[model samples]
Target chain A: MTADVAVLGAGMHPWGKWGRSFVEYGTAAAREALADAGVDWCDIGSIVGADTVRGGYPGYVAGATFAKALGWQGARVASVYAACASGAQAISTARAQILSGLADVVLVVGADAAPKGFFRPAGGDRPDDPDWLRFRVLGATNPAYFGLYARRRMAVHGDTLEDFAQVKVKNAAAGALNPLARYRKRVTAEEVAASAVVADPLRLLDICATSDGGAALVLSSVDFARRHGAPDPVRIRAVSTVTPRFPNTVLDLPDIATDSAASVAPPAEPFRASIARAAYEEAGIGPEDLSLAEVYDLSTALELQWYEDLGLCGEGEAAKLLGEGATAPGGRIPVNPSGGLASFGEAVPAQAIAQVCEVTWQLRGVAGERQVAGARVGMTANQGLFGHGSSVIAVR
Target chain B: MSRKRTPVVAGWFTGDGTDGEGEADFRLLGTRCSACASVFFPREDVFCRNPGCPGGELTEVPLSRRGRIWSYTDSRYRPPAPYVSDPELEWQPCTLIAVELEAERMVVLGQGAPGVALADLAVGMEVEAVPGVLNEDTETTWTTWHWRLTGTPGSAEAEADAKGAAGVVA
Candidate 1:
């Protein structure tokens, strides 16, 4: 197993469509995390920033930008971009530095001010970019891909529209309890059914929205945590960042065609499952050990897919598990007690770190209204565009 | 004066025939790895993606025009830019289908034929390729391929009419 890194602090800026700069949101989150960790900015040995493409120049050099905003003490800096998995990649970088003894304390931060309406590719006639090609050739928006998966589930597993709606209902209930969530009001199945359809078989309520938000975490060596007078601390046990095996059969986002399985037999385990398995393997724990999970719910249907991928239930049994209240509050293993992306929408770079933040809070018995009672272990899973895989396991 | 006809992207589709007789001549062009025997749509003229095999030459090959519907969906809202639809016109939802070519063991995405709505599709239904115009103006007609479900009533007649209207033979 990998050496443990203590989560010294976690923080976030409330998610919304606030038309502010990403730097401001990230800086606010960083300060909160630093305060929570009881460590001053000058004490931080290193900083890692999850990169954002929207904020122009500052977004690209997010680490330096945030360091400057926090009054640069000349901390070691690194910036990483892996689409939705950017935050997890940042956390991984910090963990590596701490494990290698390059730094005793590292700060990881991700934040974004999202564009209005559907997320689109960068402007240009560049045909080489797969993202731009998918938009230009097929006009397949992100929701369109979500619709395909939702419909495929219905056809393959007999999942229903109500099943999808129930996901929003469950998550919205949890989000309502999260003070930092953008949309905190409870959502009803009736309200979901009344929502307009964005893509066939998936409605506006079924899909997560785009929002501006930030999430940050302060990570320190286990030795450092003990030295700081904390005998025991919430520790991150694993961070899985694996790429998909060759001949990925699933038609993922931004790709018009699946990798041909003709030449080589496809891997038995699909990409999403591998992401969770890697984390489980590295942490020396299985899905059965998970007290709670935070999955990327880009759409309601996708959440059900994660249940199976994370091995929470058997294939085609996610709908059954949801129907049985097994994934709801007061259930055997509650999932997404932190409101999930359904409540927060997506801030891209901020999301994976936000998941870790939620896991850390739950493990510490400090999640307040959204706390999973006596939560001992938690996991967060997300995948990004291209071939980025992210999953983190935290234990107390 | 005749409006100019052009392929949206060159070398992805077959035929220079403009007559209605060439309706059967339509096919998607792809490439196959000579070493690994992998097939690629939108044609990979580059090296093989199979990590296990040494690099091989990619040869252009016409893909199967028919395949089963792996899954289908439609855009209920207007997509973002670079899609080239006029903003002024009333938005029309477009059906998109993912077809699984059994021989190649791959799935390719394409737009559905005109008037084929979500109600007309099923997960395993068979669909065939047919030439269609994506958009047109006084200057140029953008040519592309559309998938029409096989065995639909009047599908053949409709295909012939669409072919003639687009001024394509096959």
Candidate 2:
């Protein structure tokens, strides 16, 4: 609401499985972003990294690790881990540093070199850790959690598998236009339906793959940006990192069951919905004012779920809105213009940062083929595991 | 000789009596919140997850001897997990059951008891939580739970082991 930080530059390593280290990807993205911002790496006052658990040690030391890889300038560094929302958290960390005047310029980086199959827990028989326990006990792969969500939708919303596949179709069609997207080929509903079922009601095509990718952003204070001969830069208005209210009733991933609604009535809005509401409130904007949104679409059905969660449409009507192509590239408010997890797969920490990078690019009108037309305002909404709020709003 | 039959998981159930050619007595292992009188399946020991109440001691608590089948589904594909499987072997569907434990007021998931048919199980059907073999290595056996549908017509297949399969929490 007050003097927010400006997004001076953004960069990314194309999303794919390269089987390399996370540091390599983050360094490359960091170099690209620094070059784009025309700011020397040494000039960056602080660095923040979004961590990836799947990527071993470097991913954990992400911020300082990437700084060391880039020939450490001794910038104050911080690393954050919030599952898929890691990148947004990294950006929020950098924003806080910038807005606090502790740093005139900040570098935010998030990258991941993911595993081949279902992301499992670190080698251990630890029954105490919920992440490990879920895998050990239920064998609920991430897709199974996605499956549970999809099934619940079918039971409650009368949503069909066809509706889910169409989301893949729409996103893939848009992905075809994104050069940075891993899978640029257009997909059909028939094709999606034919793909092997990874989980009940969700086919292989319906699920996003694990990928190795990187994204970085160069953020600066508004005063610094203006002084650097960059006037009217894209401004980051809000970063919502709110947690869920009490009486949590929804069954989230890695959990065996939902909290009992019998104890207290569940809240009207879910955690994801609250994520966007907070961002909108902070930005002094609403969904009607948005030109585009980037939501975590881990599965095709999940994208439609985000539609309701982000208040793009009322609950259970996401399927209808999607069927009408309201979320496509040319739609009224395009969702996932950066191809989403559908095309990019999941690069973990990098994905949320990548969303902000897309919004920055779109607002700057530099986004080549996948640009949202006349985009003035954009919001990237995502939720991290174990109740972490990760969403960012950028406006021109 | 064929591989020596053993419990798939170790330390889950006691009383070594086979239900058929390859089975053991069933028990669902969990921990009880000594503070709130609540129970958690898959066991919780670090701290009582109940936020409203003051911190309490947690001890290993056995779950309900029997439960009702709240919902059921089948994994047509092999689940990748602590679940061990052979890629060389042909895949067979394993029935996944969600059972509602009355005392815990929580649902636990497990494979259906051996010989329990997918068609025979239904919502609200009386079921019992029992120990089942998940897999085994030469050194260790991974034990887990299963829900055997009870009182279904022509359920003699599950009758012999029904009572013992669903173990009472000690």
Candidate 3:
């Protein structure tokens, strides 16, 4: 098993379309995390920032930017960008630093001030970039791909539109309890049906929106945590950052086509499933051991897909599991207890870090009304563009 | 006066071909790996993505004209920039289909023919490739390919439908 790193503190700026710079949100979250950890900025040996593309110049050097915003103290800095999985990458980098004995105390932060409407590629005529080609050639926006998955689920698994709407209803109810969630009011199936269709078979409410948000974590070595007066703290056991095996069959985001399976047989497990499997293997635990899960619910349908991918249920059994209330509050394996993207919308870089924060809070028994009773183990699963895997397994 | 016809992307579609008695031949162009026989759409000219096989030369090949619809959807709102469309014109929702080619064993995505609404398509319906104009101005006409419901290529009904579907770019 990999060495563990104590999660000394976790914090976030409330998720919403708050018009502000990413640096400001990140700094706010970082300060809160520092205060929670009772660790001064000057004592931190390292700072890692999840890069945001929309932040322009400062975003590219996010670690230094956050350092500057927090008052530069000459701490070692690292910046990472893996599309939506930026936060997890940031955490992975910090964990590596701690495990290698390079740093005793590390602060990881991710924040984004997202643009309104569909996320588009940077303006250019470059045909080589897959992101640009998908838009310029097919005009296949992100929702279009989500609609394809939703429709495919309806055909393959006998899922219905009602099943998809129930996901929104359940997550919305959970979000109503989360103070940091942007949409706090519970949503209903009728409201989801009444919403305008952004893409065929997917209404505006069925898909997550773009938002401005931030999340941060203060991590330290186990020895450092004990010395700092917290002998027992929420610890990250595994951070799975794997890539898709060759001949990937699933049509992932921003890709116009899947890799051809003519030359080599595709792997039996899809890319997303392998992501969770890697984490499970590294953490030496299975899905049944998980007290709760926080998955990237980019769309309500996608959440059901993640249920199966995470092995919470068998293939084509996600809807049945949801029907049994297994993924709802007070159920066997509650998901999105902190209100997933369904409630928070998406802040890209900030999202994965926020998932870990939710897991950290739940593992510590301090998640308030949304806390899972007797929670000991929690996991977060997310995938980013260009085949970046982001899943974390945490335990107290 | 004749308007100049240009491809939205060069070498992606066959140049206008006319046989005796004026029949047009159209096909989407792709590449096939010489070593592994793997097919690529939007044509991978440089290297074969198949990791098991050693590097091989990629040669141009014509893709199958017909395939089954694996899944489909439509953009209900105007997609942001890079996709060219006139803002003044009424926004017409365009259907997009992921077609699974049996021989190539790969799914290729494309815009559906105009007048083909969500009501007209099923998950496994068969669609055929056909040449269509994406957009046109006084100076040039951008030509691209569209997927239409499988029917007799030159029948009068198909011709009328193709005319209606032309220029309805995504």
Candidate 4:
């Protein structure tokens, strides 16, 4: 196994449609994380920020923006953007710096003020961008893709609409207890059924929403954690930022076509499965050892896809696992104990980092009502557009 | 007066027939790498993407006109722009299908033919690409492609014309 980075602190600005600058949310979360870690701002050796696409210039150089807002102590800064996987990439960068002894303590932060309704591409016509082409050519929104996956599950795996609703039901129940979640009211299968259909087979409630939020983490070398008087802290064991292999067969977001597999044969394992496999190999642990997981439930059906991808269940058996209550609280292995994107909606850049924060809280046995009993090992999985794959494994 | 018919993006397909009635020899165009033999849609004009193969010349090639439906869905809500549609008119949901061409072993996404509903489509059902209108303004008509089920009498005529077509639409 590779060297570990101690998660010294985890904090977040409560998720919701709070109209405010992203900088405000990120700064608040940073201060809270520093307070939680009991570390002084001047003492941090480095800072990393996951970039948001809006806000023009500042969004691109987010690290300097957060550092300047937090009163620049002249600490080293790095900014990263990988669409939805930006947060994980930031954490990965910090971990690399700590392992290489570039810095003893590093702070990672991400935040976003998302646009309402459908998230669209930037203004003007750019035919070269796939994201723009999907909308202009076919009018395929994000939910359209989710609906396609959900329908495929129904046809191939016998997954009913009820099964997809159950995922929302379970996650909303857990989210009801999470004060930080935007939609805290427990949702019912009936409510999900009554929701408007944004795309065929997938209701509005089945898909995640866009929201304004922020999440931050304070990380340090294990030796530094001990010196700071925290004898034991949750450790980040693995961060997988893998890309898809050539001839990807599945149709993913922002793409109008799958790679032609006519000449070169496709990979044995698909992209999502390969993402988890890499993390497991690096962390030296299997799905059986996971006490809980925080998977990107962009759509309920997608969450079920992650179940099979993470090796929590066999192929086409995710619905069976969900029906068995194996993925709920106090079950075989709880998935998305933080209510996932189902409860929290999506904060884009902040989400992958927030997933790590949720896993950290669960590992500490401090997740309160949503806590998994005797939680020790937790994993978070998320995928971004343009073939970016993110998954992290943390253990106490 | 008729507005000028134009391909929304250039060179992806043949013909500027935006009327959806019949484009006798319309077909989606893609590029094939000479060395690796990998085919790219939306036409990759640059170097071959296959990491294993040495870069080679990418020549434009006509993609298969017919394929089977891999999956399908419909957009009930108006998608956000650069999709040009009249806000003044009530939104009409359209079916989107991913078709798998056996020859290319690839899935291409396209809007289903006007009036084609989800009820009419099934996994592995055969469909053929045809010309359609994306949007139109006073000065120009944006032309795009649509996927319709094969065996329709209109598609049969297009298939016959495609066999003898030599010149690619500029």
Candidate 5:
């Protein structure tokens, strides 16, 4: 097999409600990434963009949108959408193009100008749609799902509200250092407690907000990197886009119910674990080799679930790890040193790419206050709505 | 005091909501195949989902109205469209609960009635599925059913019924 592609550059438009078009955010990120990689717009071989459902439709397929904004350099363009995994899908598209010799240098970008509140599907009255059904029939919201997971964790793992609050505390402390984050101010458990309850079990502080942000990356073939005068580069070792097995046990987003295990036997690993397991299998690395992790912390308790899903600790031991500070910056494995969704809120398509951005920074020893010391291997894991799973492993 | 509420969507809960009191109050829902039963909620309108064996036609089934709280949460933030929220008024958080159905063997999520609060709910508490209004406009009122936790007895039977429900999910 051909060696992995080199992550030549990573860039972002600092996340916030800038009240600008997504095209602006995406173009800015793309230009910054091109500049960082020292690659002229004309030199790039291909472009892949993660499309976000925008005003009236997915505004501008990210690739073409950015290309048009960048003045249409005539690079081969491709766009992919996988909900929250859109960025990872874009990265995967770039990797495939490079491996197939379709392009020597590729640019992958994702950006979104999110609406103010909970993300809902386009205005519709479709009974055939499960997403619409959930909202229409049950009035079930995203936080409702997050609350279900939190309550389940408490019942099964005995994870306390305090444990969930600690995740916020640790992540907020780390987020305090992330200038790119929307909420740079640190949060305390007491503050989390005092915050109004948005959903039961999860309060206002426990949930991630919606924000506008953009992230882009420049990737090139190993040979291209060597010829470009860069001796060593952070290599993208694995890009896992795994789908769930037939009998998916966990209740995921958009779906009102989980796949019934009543008929077929359940997989040894749950769907979330399988997402990370596939990445580790592809990368030839285990959780122990990871210097840090970036997980989708939609809620504080969900982050604790991810701790178990990523094999950071055994089931029911996530709270213990938190208690021991194993996931804190100075602790064993720093999880969400970019402050996670707790600080970054969420930029959907851009969020996953941003996770890789954080990993790239940490691996390069550039993550100032939240650095995981001597970091070598880092992994970013996330699951998009529907069945899309995202995991990217990078190494120095 | 009220106009009327018609179930906006059909094939969901089957019961007489307009009746002040009647036997039709018991909601008739969907049931999975006993042999190759794969649970579904919103009453699976079609066939059994089990992959391993002989397929069979689904039957109109009545799910257990009373069950225990498998889990509960709420919508702190107003959800996006298709979900109705009155922006003119300050939004209030609603209690969302997942209750295990005994005969269908799955969990269904529903909004708690007006008085239910998070403090009133806990895992393993007793809950019952009750129909509620989903949305309202001048022309129409959307009606739906949800599980509400009741701090009561018979939770063991509810759990057992959920096991028997065989896998119907919300």
Candidate 6:
């Protein structure tokens, strides 16, 4: 296993549709993280920025842009883009810098100002781009894909619409306690059923909305953390950023078809399962050791999918686990204690970092009302477009 | 004014220029890796995607027309472009299906044939790819593929519905 990086501080700008530039939100989050870490901007040896592709030219050079916004001190900078996994990649970069002795302290930041309505591909007639082709040829939006998965779950696992609604109820309740969450009002199964249908078998409330937000983290070498008078801190034990193996059988996003499995057999473990396995292996911990988890609830059904993938339960047992309250707050293993995307909506670039921030607070036992009791080990799981797999394991 | 019949994206399918006036031969086209025996839809034109295989010539291959429905869903709202649709027209929810081709062992996604409602479909139901219009503009008729249920008299009804609703994707 690789050496761990100490999570010196974690911060967020509070998710919302605030109609502000991403730079503003990112700067605010970065400043908060720096203040929390008791590290000055000029003292940081490196900075990493998770890019928001929707932010145009400046978004492409996010590292330099955020560095400029925070006032340049010639710190080493790097930018990464991996759709929803962007923030995790930024965190990975910062952790790498610390472990390699390249930087004693590094700052990671991600932010976004999302547009209204469904996210569309960049303007073009490029049939070469699968994201564009899916929309152009089949009129298949992101919700359409979610609908397929939800329906498949109903057919395969006998999961009911009410079961999906309960996930929303569970998450919304927790989000109500988190001031950073955008949708603080607790949601009910009745309300979820009453919401408009965006895709078959999935309602508007089942899906996450796009939002404007930012998240930042200050990471340092363990020695640095000890020298800085914080002997015990939340440590990042693993950051898994794996890609799908060949012959991926699952219908992933931005693709019109799955890779053929005729010649080569499909992997025993699917992509999402592998993502968690890699993290668990590196962290040297299993699901039994998890005090809590922060999963990407892009859709309520997807949260159930994560349960199975994360090994919280066996395959096809996710609904049963949820039904038994195993995943609810104060239960066996609380999930999405910060409310997940269901409550926070999706700030894309900021999301993965935000998940880590939640885990950090829970591990530090400072997650006021929604804290997982006696939390010591926590994990965050997220998947992004184009086979980008992300998961982070942190422990105190 | 007569608009020219065109494939939405060329070389993805086989079609004749009858433009729904006649039963033009139609089939979805894909490419197969000669080295790895792997198949790709939307026709991979360049190199073999299989990492185990050394570079080999990709050959044009027609995919199996018949398959089983792996999953299905319907879009209740209008999708944003580059999917061409008239904003003036009331949105007609379109059923989307993911069909599993046994021969290729791959799942291909397509719009369900017109009149095929979600209530009419179930997992593992048989489906076949057929020629259909994606959208139309002043000078171009964009031809594409649609997956319609196979077996029983319901298949006939779906075909009739598709013909009746020709060129109206939304």
| The candidate that achieves the highest DockQ relative to the unseen native structure | 6
Q: Is candidate 2 or candidate 4 better by TM-score?
A: 4
Error of 6 at A147 (Å): 0.6
Off by over 4 Å in 3: B15-24, B152-170
* Residue-wise C-alpha lDDT for candidate 5, range A2-96, written one tens digit per residue: 36889999999989899998888888988888887888888998999999887335454778888888887789999899989999999999999
1 against 6, candidate with superior lDDT: 6
In terms of lDDT, the poorest run of 10 residues in model 2 chain A is: A257-266
Give the range of the ten consecutive residues with the poorest summed lDDT in model 1 chain B.
B161-170
For candidate 3, write residues A1-396 as lDDT tens digits: 998999998989999988989999999999989998999999999999999999897998999999999998999999999999999999999999999999999999999999988899998798778899778777889999999999889888999889999999999999999999999999999999999988888999999999999999999999999999999999999999999987888888888777777667889999999999999999999999999999999989999999999999999999999999999999999999988999999999899999999999899898899989999999999999999999999999
Give the alpha carbon lDDT tens digit for every residue of A182-242 in model 6. Answer: 9999999999999999999999999999999999999999999999988998999999999
Ordered by DockQ, highest first, the candidates read 6, 4, 1, 3, 5, 2
Query: Retained native contacts per candidate, as fractions?
Result: 0.75, 0.19, 0.65, 0.84, 0.58, 0.87
Error of 6 at A343 (Å): 0.4
lDDT of 6: 0.92
lDDT of 4 by residue, A227-289 (tens): 999888999999999999999989999889999999999999999999999999999999999
| Per-residue alpha-carbon lDDT of candidate 5 for residues B1-170, written as tens digits (9 for 90 to 100) | 45576776776666637445332274636566665666556566566666665777676667667777778887776766677789998878888877765555566667776678888887877777666677788876677765554432233344556567532233
TM per prediction: 0.96, 0.86, 0.95, 0.96, 0.90, 0.96
CAPRI class of candidate 2: acceptable
Worst 10 residues of 6 chain A by lDDT: A54-63
lDDT of 1 by residue, A193-271 (tens): 9999999899999999999999999999999999987678899999999999988989998898888888789999999
CAPRI class assigned to model 6: medium
Q: After superposition, how far is residue B7 of candidate 5 from its true place, in Å?
A: 1.9
